[model samples]
Target: MVKKVIRIILLNIFSLFPLDSRKIIFESNSEIKDNSKALFLKILDLGVNSKYKIIWPVENPKECKDAFKEYKNVSFVKKSKSGSSSLLFLYHCCTAKYCFYTHNPLGQRTREGQRKVFLTHGTPIKDTRGMFWPPYENTDIISTSEFAAYLRCKTFGGGDDVVRLLGFPRNDFLFKTDKGTEEYFDKIKKSKFIIWLPTFKRHNISVKRRDFDEDKNSDISILSPGFMEKLNNYLKAKDILLLIKYHPSQNLDYVSLKSYSNIITLTNDQLEKNNVDLYSLMGKSDALITDFSSVYIDYLLVNKPIGFELGDYKSYKNGRGFIVDNPLDFMPGEKIKSPGDLYTFIDNIFSGVDKYEEERIKLRNKMHKYVDGDSSERVLRYFELIN
Candidate 1:
């Protein structure tokens, strides 16, 4: 309470500035109003010093204004300026009082006088798979998780001196009032939901979003037809509701999976229609099934069972691989490569033959050490805009 009050006071003071020179900007080519990015913008808006100003760059004003009409302190920038003019325009824009980056290279390239903070928003950045890009210098890297920070350093080669362990404010949703941890448990107590979160396989061309044309050449992960069939059977036999959740950017068409009564294919349309809270969805599930996504870490909050779909383990590792201290021993939960194998594993657990929650709890404890609900508050404190 006291801390929040302090922040509010400081923000009021910052907002009182007469000039627009105290602006903080978030730059991205993607839709700034999208759910993934919007969540971050929303949090920052909460601590926005009304006077300091916040801006978003949009290639098209009509589109951005139409989408973000509800949000104040957001403006569009059209770089009608070309060639050296474009560079100059970008450089001039970066001269904000403070600029926050969700990823790398945008502001770091030429943010000469701006107070820049690199905020990593997603979990896929750790591996060299799918859309891996070379790492470069950053101002100060704000990490959502310690493991994420470790992976950043190990793969990107940085040390603690430059990295700040401030969790992603967007994740504050996981701990929000009325719809957070407690609310999640209340809803989950009623149903047996299973989340199947798989990374895009190398040849899964359909997984790429339609907007991202550059990813048309991507490959899908190794799939075992027999395994998929067997897993489908298990869902049918148990009368369990199976939810397949993939990356948001992945252009996955889950319409085919609807043929199965027990299987629920989550598509982008479904995501937008339901306005589902992922943390709540994961919380409601009995167990989680995933590949390399960091969703499992968040699911740990519910102390639910987590399993890996490693059917294409070797190939995935080869493409966008991991450096797990031990593939089998380092990670938490059981590893099942084949759907048939996963069926047997699920059967055993559902039969009340194995207590998987215990291990899930321990793993959750390890992964969650850095993720208290107060991470966003920590991040806000970093600006010293508020105490």
Candidate 2:
């Protein structure tokens, strides 16, 4: 309607500027971080020559200034503003030779010759409802595997040719380590670390329902006082540490779990301050525990033990229908419904008893075509081919 007409008008107007053949833009999670950031850093480190300039946009310039201050070819632009920043964003969108994004572009359509590459945040484990909608239709290239490409085309209405077999750039670090990431591992290497990541359930809950405790319905309740105390006692005895990475949409009161010596909650501010990303944490962890999150699929690359807590599977599946026929069939871990069951499974995993390792390896091979550390190189080569 009117917005579409306005967008077309703006795009056409912005096209009057001369295109910068050597300019490239990168974005992740609507911020300057994610898969796109990881890829950009790798490309920067390769010293791929000085012809190309990299433009990154962030909601707050000061927050990320330190992180990018050392790079000579990189420029940070504010994402929101009344005048200059907005105009700069528009100009970059309209004139940049290539744009790599984890999500869709913010505003303005891609000019005729410009390329838009979608480096998806994670592999598909749940139904992505709006992926087939208008915003994603203009993606010229999408990074995914043959198996995942088929599923994306079938579920998200994209063509097969747009799918590139290059593995996710963020996952590249999972196979190798460097001085930068070794510090993060050293902090937790003393104890066996297990990360519990659960999908968001706010959309399925009504705000007007006073009786519903959203935290209880999701897997966050595993950190309840009683259960955490019991889990902490067992973990301390076994020298195991449990880390909870909550979904961005879930707002849980972490005060209860803060007192436990063995339980730690990873906060967004902490992650930003330390310059650590989710995939890096996943790579360093000994095991993963999740329910309906695509993180487990990525963790499969590490070939570690995984546990599932599907206490609310029926409600979630009914409320948000799945793209797969039977979600349970795709899971490569034990399904534990209660806290006791979860603890018992973890105890077994710690005691050198893993029945699901074979199944996990099989699923990992099926989902990811390449496990080498050259996914970033593949993406850079693809850009070279098109350029």
Q: For residues 1-387, could you state the per-residue lDDT of candidate 1 as single tens digits?
A: 875665445444443433235666665433352222543444555645455555655455567677667766666565421211133225434456566655333443333444556665554332533332334446667665566667656655554466777665555555553334354345333235677876654223433333212232222232333445656677677766677766654544321334255565665445544546665466456778886666665666656577777655565555455645454543467777655567765675576554567776666554455645566567657876446
lDDT of candidate model 2 versus the reference:
0.70
Least accurate stretch of 10 residues (summed lDDT) in model 2? 203-212
lDDT (C-alpha, whole model) for all candidates: 0.54, 0.70
lDDT of 1: 0.54
List candidate 2 stretches off by more than 4 Å. 1-8, 80-85, 106-110, 178-181, 203-219, 253-259, 385-387
Off by over 4 Å in 1: 1-21, 27-29, 33-49, 58-64, 76-93, 108-113, 123-126, 129-136, 144-147, 176-190, 203-233, 249-259, 348-366
Residues 1-387 of candidate 2 have per-residue lDDT tens digits of 875676567667888887777888877644766678778878778865366888877677675767667767777677752222455666677888778887655334546667777777777757675544443444555545677767666665665666778888888777766654577657765458888887655522233422223335334555566777788888888888888766654444422435367777765656666666777777787888888887787788889888898877776676655678888988988897887788887787688678889999888888889866678888888779323
TM-score of each: 0.71, 0.88
